[model samples]
Target: MLVLLLLWTGCGSAVPPELAPDLILHNAKIITVDPDFRVVEAAAIKGSRFLAVGSNDHVLNLAGSQTSLVDLEGRTAIPGLIDSHIHALHFGWHITKHVNFSTGERLTVESMVARIGEWAKNVPPGKWIYARGPYSLDFVAEGRLPNRWEVDAVTPENPFFMNMQGHVGVVNSYAMRLAGVTKRTPDPEGGKFVRDPKTGELTGIVYEFPAMNPFRGLIPRHSLEDNLNAVRKANEVFNSLGITSVVNLAMPQWEFAVLRQLWRDEGLTVRWTAMLRADARVFLNKPYSEVEAEMRALGPPTRFGNDWLKINGIKIVLDGFVEAAYMREPYLEDIFGKGWRGILLWDRESLKSALRAAGKYGIQVAIHVTGDAAVDVALEVMDEVDREYPVAGRRWSLEHAGVMPTEENLEIAERLKVIISTQQSMGWSIGKTFKKWWGPEMGGIFAPNKTWLQALGHPYLKAGSDNRPINPFIGFWAYLARKDVDGEVAKPEEALGREDTLRLYTSNAAYGIFEEKERGSIEAGKLADLVVLSEDIMSVPEDQVREIKPVMTVVGGKIVFQQGS
Candidate 1:
């Protein structure tokens, strides 16, 4: 009996200890972005999760014989950035194909025409030629709309069209002819066909819904393979920038199908949460049981689909861009002394009904509300629905929340736990234009980010790039430095501290996506998703933040990207 007891004890002791980690990273400045926002020196990864995060000695001790060790070489590491709002497939498609007109001296119509003429000469004859990201209104001091004749002079045979802000476009005569639009073609409801004042002819400029439908039908439909290729290209760009996850703001049904195909094929690299476009009428009109069953069959909303993709929420655009004067607001006078109030896509009753129905189904809604008036209306609808359906923990978000929201609206949002998914880059990009239109007082009131800070006293605010060439670093700089893209400082008093700005991109963004508990921070038991930067962002001068580049990016314990040595 004594021998047996001793043998049993020896056997238990001989059971091999748990194996150590497969990877260890040490001698690094690691910004955890955790609850305490801790900074550590070393981190150990077992397979796809952080096993230990602490001192270099502690983390190194967990490294097994075959563990790959990475010396940080004095570089700085932070949590992998997750863009809260981006049009993933669209961005990919446009970047790969479209003629980017956002930059250069060719901002004016004449310059644009000259450039298009140059482009048309090289492309195949009769091919569908497309260009995007033009800002003709910016150059037209009188806010003159571009007409088909101007574009026709450049590419008469080519069906040329370019989107100004995703909500409006100007097409050439060929494209217009293909769409069968004429001067007498009545403007579709909820859309406007810009007309020549003297001739009363269609000018090829269209706004809101009407403009979108015709071209949308004519535009070459992306094949599943083409979309997958686009996704691959997008992932390469994102991983290069250390962006591991992104919330695709709005994806069309076909694009969603492509994403699903990529996921099934295990080809997706970046984690995605897709917001189904509200215009997906067929899906929205389906029976609740049918919809639920379809969603279930596809899969639940996930952070990474256990590896790559996720479907988080639905997106709805309530109004048009602020520049187009389509945002509902305190009416402002245009250059011609015409008072133009903004246009709402859906009537108040329709919006309210949709919100109520969405809330009932437990689907979080992300509504695009740019102007204060629009914000107020959205809040009112959300509040009404919350009173009835009462989503307890779901994080509904207000996209763009650019203008100053009312104190009452802020309070309600705080109480109901709605997130302000703002594009801080706007303060730099378009805030100057607002100042010109409304003057100092009203313009200052327009992007009253400070007002929200004071009213709600640190509400859940997430920073979004809006895919305007404003990455996390640019956003950080804008928020902390209070500087415009041109290096001019905005209202200094509205500027947030560096730490606060970081939180806006990291912790707050994660919270907005209902992913706060998993990947926002660097900690044990959490996914080892992080980025290493060439410079220490926290300690760098505010003006230099944009200069910093990602040196390395890790997702799910694997190094996905590394800057060329």
Candidate 2:
């Protein structure tokens, strides 16, 4: 019956001649996220590339006897999803090792300490305990992080470190002592060691990665096999969610090796773009000349490796996130101190010089500028470097421009051709805290999706999940609705149209990694990476967007995931 049906459909008088396809999917709402955003009836794939796309009659004519035909029966098919920014290793390790406290409801001092106490029972005495958080200072009933003494009460023998959203960290006394971080230990450059004002004692709260790295360095990483297994597990999850490509950020050389090995071993199922970190021990604390020489040794600017795993570029953190972000204006209330805006992790001259050095090596740089002030600094740095290099297609990205860029700054970004790789997951998961910390005025303006769309337009603006919730649907829902957990809208005017939001994670994302021409859309000649969804996301009710699931995810014309598989 299948062969008979194909014979009837494939034989058409006056049909244009076409090549045979390895696979044919018919009766689908093929959302070709192309320039015109065309929707077609069917698509045909030949050996990892899209063979033809158009009405069923056109595509079916391309199918041969060997073509594996699939009748979608009116399912929605889209380009396989892309996560523009994620810490794959960190996410993988966390998923395997720790319990998540990102939901806000489970983020109290009592609850965290109790969970730690329970976890300590299994850990050997004097061993390290690490916990990852989506924690905020506002989430706790006390409106502050728990003290070391409080954490100590639960695990006096076991040293513990709670990593809070990559910005702040809480350490028990045992952990502090292990690192020898006494009250006399001076604050590191570009980082703060929170201390009690009255007693001048260490509060055990470490702010910024620079400050936390000393203690963090003491923890032993998982074995190579374990890390690889964790990444495999994470990829399984990513594939299940229709994520075919991810730009994994802040990857040091070692982690990149692991991912490369996974690809070589055929264990990698998702396309990975690893952005090298500048602060790896090899570059950190080194003179500019040394760092430049080291980066130059890494090879050329063009992406290296095959479609599965490739080196994207360099990543650097210029500032913190959330309330710790270095802002031009002070927060609604002074939480750090009087005149406390936030921490500037690099001096203007040093930052400019570092950027120029990276540019000299022809390396694409991705800067973590979570604040508007930091965004300005990053733009200035980019401008300086671009002038020095006089190169086009630099495509340096600004990761997590948390605050909405001013019109003038957006214009600067356009002029510089910088990609705005921001996230909507932050709003969906932490919108309430943003309001409480930054006040209604600034918090409501947090992402400013609509403003960005109007200013920078579609091609330059790409949305990332940041892995807080790790659900792209939540990112989709966040951008479309702009609503908090309470259903209170934050800058409802900034909500994006459904098509624009979809592009944020699709074609624009491909553009971010300079893969726009190769994949990202269900167009003929593009790589056959696509997803079949249970519901049509474009026309679905806004609230129902989050509940939509991928029935199948195909990468390189191979089905990597299917519902119930």
CA RMSD (A), model 1 = 5.3
> Taking the tens digit of each residue's C-alpha lDDT, what string does model 2 give over 1-565?
3344345565653222244688999999999999999999999888888877899977877666778899999999999999999888877877777655665474667887788789888888988888886545545665667789998998889888988888788898999888999999999875789999999999989888778988999988888998898799889889888899999888888888889788888657799988888764455556788767877875456487779888867888887677677888887777666766877777677676667777787678889987778889888777777777853477888888867777667777878777888788777677777787677877632487677667777788897777766778878888888877667887777778989988999999999898999978998889999999989999989999988999999999999999997
Per-residue alpha-carbon lDDT of model 1 for 207-253, expressed as tens digits? 76565588767878666677788788888788888788888887765
Clashing pairs in 1: none
lDDT of 2 at 448: 74
Best by lDDT: 2
Provide TM-scores for the models.
0.87, 0.90
Q: What is the lDDT of candidate 2?
A: 0.81
Highest TM-score, which number? 2
